[model samples]
Target chain A: MDDYRELKPEDLVEDPAFRAWVYHGTGAEAWNEWVNEHPDHAQAADLARNILASVRGELDSFPGSEVKNRVQRILESLDAGRSGTHPADRSANHRDRRLWWQAAAAGLVLAAGLGALIYTRLPEAPAEKKSVAFVRAPGTSDQTHLEIVNDSESPRLVNLPDGSSVLLKRASGIRFPRQFAVAKREVELSGEAFFEVKKNPEHPFFVYAGQMVTRVIGTSFTIRSYQSDATAKIRVKTGKVSVWAAETVLTASQEPSTGIQELVLEPNQQAEFSRSDLKFALLENDRPEVAPIPIEQMSFEFRRTAVSDVFEAIRTAYQVDIRYDAGLLRRCSVTASLGDEPLTEKLNMICEVIGATYREKNGKIYIEAGGCE
Target chain B: MRPKLILQEDPVSPLWQLLCSGDKDAFGQITENCYKPLYHYGTKFTDDRELIKDCLQDLFLDIWEKRAHLSGVANPRPYLFQAFRNNLLRRTRRVSRFSEIGAEDELEFSSFSYEAEWIHRETEAGLEQKLQLVMKQLPKRQREALYLRYYENLTYEEIADVMGLRRQAVANYLQYGIQKLRDYWQQVVISLVLLLAS
Candidate 1:
């Protein structure tokens, strides 16, 4: 008990009896008495208790029947092994067979890569020719379309004709018209891409990815729709977007649509469209076990934050390089909520507040300012 | 000075001894008691249920074969965990080498929503989400150390033995992990205050 007199919260968290008391009410009276005696340590003790309880709350366990079944299988195998059958020899054999098959598959993949490399060495063909080929819709064949495919290792920025922009991930492709239609703007996407749609209330933006269509007036969101994946997902970053199944949209095109199962997603909400059942499931960002929301969706809210720190936050969240003199901006501070505006608008607002000017060159933002007043 | 509570000795020690002395029923009892916790812990490593099941079977079978040599083991739970973790990692590495799977040895906690009633009202709204984010971003070794300390309830020395680190290193990992959570909590409180003020 005396040893606990000078213990920090961390030390108390590691104490077994203290943990037992917090977890199961074991020796609660003694711990309560100790806390009463040492008023100064009570806060530390309470903090430690909270930490331990929260951690314990995160634990997950399997069902008792499942445990029993697994144990039964193991004991049965042991019983068989005791009766002159060698489980060790059998498992070793199984491992050898698996290793052999894996080695064969690796060799085949290596051969294919070597063949592709040899073919690429010839100068007649363009490098992007071997990448994804864009397929034009039958009815829209007369309309000129532009396609951008990102086959490189880094994200590629595509500036749409309407001032909207997309940061396309590796192995992704986006196809849009040369000029927007008078009624709306539309794009076709494959794989994953983060989109920042330009605000046009009269002409809503539509994204057709896999078996789903996402309609947004002016917002940023991410859509992941791989050809090989079982489900396509759209996560809203800012504002609201309505998602509908492609079949529903097609049917609505023929007639007035009513009672349509359209899912409206807000910031931090996501909708997953399963290809098998053609159903949409809504999810919140609170579930950490699910695939994380892209960094672009991270919200930014600064309350009297340093101007330099604000730029740093944007730089990291957008994965873009920003050149600025941190020492000059150290004295400049701003209080504003961000994350709903586009990258340029965010920069514009921040620079306006700090009396700074910024220029974009070669995909980087450079800020110039004489020290703040 | 306050009185110290009398802690009970490890209850699994006698069962472990009996298993070592060629008692099959004792081995069964150990398996039944340990399989669920071990399975839950294995989930922190990988999501492949088949792979985890295979490794667990291999672990228990190996233990039965080498019971004579394991009699000197004082703590059975941590000892089993160490062995099982090593086996799972070795198998995953072997599989990933040929398959090109991401075999980074990181622990992933199972996702479960915090019960709102259980959380303190002041910090209840978004604390769980922030905690999850912080937990995800923690270094792999620190997360494992914290898991062993809080989830498995292992002492620093036992955790050190399991992780093959010095006892002080385990202590440092727990301190750093807990401090990160505390810092995030403070930030959340401050942000809430600012939100209310505005």
Candidate 2:
């Protein structure tokens, strides 16, 4: 309005409330008035609001207990301000250095002896520890490496490129490429990652795990597809995503021979699939039917499963291999959460219940029967 | 000097002095004074509570840590609010939580702005609750614009800068909010009149 043009800066100075409203609302109508009357006051008012906001926000959202604890530990370490083993004023003279070498030599000898004794006395079995091998794409950097530490101890934050963040769950490992390609962004995930994807409409992000793939333009979601589980699942926390199984079987008579079947998912929906049988099952807000039957079935009952699967979860979950002394393969059933139990403990527990002993050698666990009938 | 003297100095002068001196107490007092209006600004802009909290918290922490190096904080409130506003925009660049809600996702200001002496004196008892009820009845854009312009004293250009809209758009939203609030109050007054007449 012309009247707004005519308004003087004095008008705003006389009315602080009006000024507050104008500034608060981001209205420029009062700008002319504010500048005309009290140009300095306009800027002054702006600074006051900003400073107040910063301080209030800090006091309001002070770090949570965990973050505070971590910061406190770091600060406490700073107070000591040294490799605490050495005194601050100590000089590394030749004599002192010699004494250190002597002490180190004596300690090494004692430690070697103790280690030898402990090694011989502690173990009854020579078991092969299975290690996970990550097959990364070419040109992947060592800095992009992800590790899942499971000691029932603490949680960790993982840093990622593209400003997209992921909080890795405990005991979960994920491997992603260091530099994301413009055409596609993909990560091989085992365990779980809560992903906050940067929205780029041109380049949609894809998460690959076994036969299932999760495609998203921009969204927040969680995926848990450990090799230990029969079915991999993708859960969306916020935003939309397209989930699909890449390896589905089709007859020759079918027009399209490709094995891809796309399933659109909204928030809170999960897409689950069994890679062996090429069957897909979707679950929402609840656990899907992962396995066909109950765990207590007689004879080895596998529904939509493969016998020659290398990372057979049943073998790990029950802790007993199918081979009975490397001759007869006992068909033992398996179904349960393996999260709480160790691989060795689970096998031992199941073996004892089924009247069998597990023998381990060179890393492979074998089931031996005592002839229960 | 006494705390009273500290308060008596021109607000801008004291704030500038305090910031230069790296006085944490002064920083905290400034924040305590400004938080409500800033919060109102944040809530009005984005309905995502978590995002607002994150942006606001990050903005303040940034200011406190960087206070020693900062220059030209003549009015700390605008700078702080502006910073918060910028943080929100940057954080929401990838895809905002509020984007999906479209126009319907207006910030519902439920909290009480109890610090305003004039509002309290006029409303008497349960003013905060009444304000909240009245706020709930406001149109999404109107409430948002009102909280930012009236509560924060931001220029229309500044609001446009924060909201990533044209200056004219901010002006329109501000006028709309004020008109709606006035209309709502007039309706209340009219209903009371009608009840008395009956």
Interface RMSD of each: 17.0, 26.4
Summarize candidate 2's per-residue lDDT along A1-373 as a digit string, tens digits: 3333433333332244433332222222344344346533433333233222211111121112323342333333334543441223323231111111111112222222222222233344133311121211111234433333321223333444555655555445555556665565656554555666777788777765544667888776677665445566776656788876532111001111134566777766777766444355777545323331111111233342322231255443232344543223334433332222224444565565545677766446666665433
Provide TM-scores for the models.
0.41, 0.27
DockQ of all predictions against the true structure, Cα-based: 0.14, 0.02
The sequence of per-residue lDDT tens digits that candidate 1 reaches over residues B48-132 is 6666777888898899999999999989988998999899888777877776565663333432213211122234457656655
Which residue pairs does candidate 1 place in steric collision? none
DockQ of 1: 0.14
Q: Per-residue lDDT of B27-74 in model 2, one digit per residue for the tens?
A: 655655555456546654554555554455556556666777775666
Task: Give lDDT tens digits, candidate 1, residues A253-330.
Answer: 211124436888988787788754567998655332234435564667889998878888877666678998888878
- Cα lDDT over the full model 2: 0.45
Distance from true position, residue A162, model 1, in Å? 43
Kindly provide the TM-score of model 1 when superposed on the true structure, using C-alpha atoms: 0.41
TM-score of chain B of each: 0.78, 0.54
The lDDT of each candidate is 0.65, 0.45
lDDT of 1: 0.65
